[model samples]
Target: MRTSSSALFGLGLVMAVDRLVFQPDRPISDVQQTLLGIVRRVART
Candidate 1:
């Protein structure tokens, strides 16, 4: 099977975050929202 770079990056980020911080029992969608918020905040500066 094959996967795009973004998919791989997301998987790596999830694993790294789970290991380094609290394991999120919430849906993955929440993380997507948080990431989007961060990007938007950066862009406004």
Candidate 2:
């Protein structure tokens, strides 16, 4: 449980950094977008 939670947190952190700093104006990578999608889907559940 902790491992999964930590992984989600880490993925979220990476997504946040990618959105805020790495690709603010530009498009994000497929990997990042996929991560974001997964996060969104998880949030809905």
Candidate 3:
């Protein structure tokens, strides 16, 4: 249960960072884009 909660917290944190830092006008590195894509896929599932 604790692990699950921590995982959820981490996901939420990632999502928050995605929205705050990855704006349309801003450019991101390839690694950052890949990480964001992975996070988005996981979020959809």
Candidate 4:
């Protein structure tokens, strides 16, 4: 259940690319809101 530094770095890269990728139908605020919701849910568990 332990996460390594590389795994964390990879996750960060993925999230960064996900945020940087252009989407005509989606906005940055929506993406941020979704990420925040996920963080909140995980924090509750």
Ranking by TM-score: 2, 4, 1, 3
Q: Write the per-residue lDDT of candidate 4 for residues 1-45, one digit (tens) a residue.
A: 255455545655666687677554577678667666766675577
Best by lDDT: 2
Candidate 1 segments exceeding 4 Å error: 1-16, 19-21
Q: Is candidate 1 or candidate 4 better by TM-score?
A: 4
- Candidate 3, residues 1-45: lDDT per residue as tens digits? 687568767866775577567764544464467656776776687
Better of 1 and 3 by lDDT: 3
Q: Is candidate 1 or candidate 3 better by TM-score?
A: 1
Point out where model 2 deviates above 4 Å: 26-36, 39-45
Model 3 misplaced regions, further than 4 Å: 24-45
Model 2 Cα displacement at 34 (Å)?
Answer: 5.1
Report every candidate's CA lDDT.
0.64, 0.79, 0.66, 0.64
Query: How does each model score on TM-score?
Result: 0.50, 0.53, 0.49, 0.52
Each prediction's number of clashing residue pairs: 0, 0, 0, 0
TM match of model 1 to true structure: 0.50
Model 1 has an lDDT value of 0.64
**Between candidates 1 and 2, the lDDT winner:** 2
For model 2, residues 1-45, the per-residue Cα lDDT tens digits are 797789898987877787788778756576577887997897787
Best by TM-score: 2
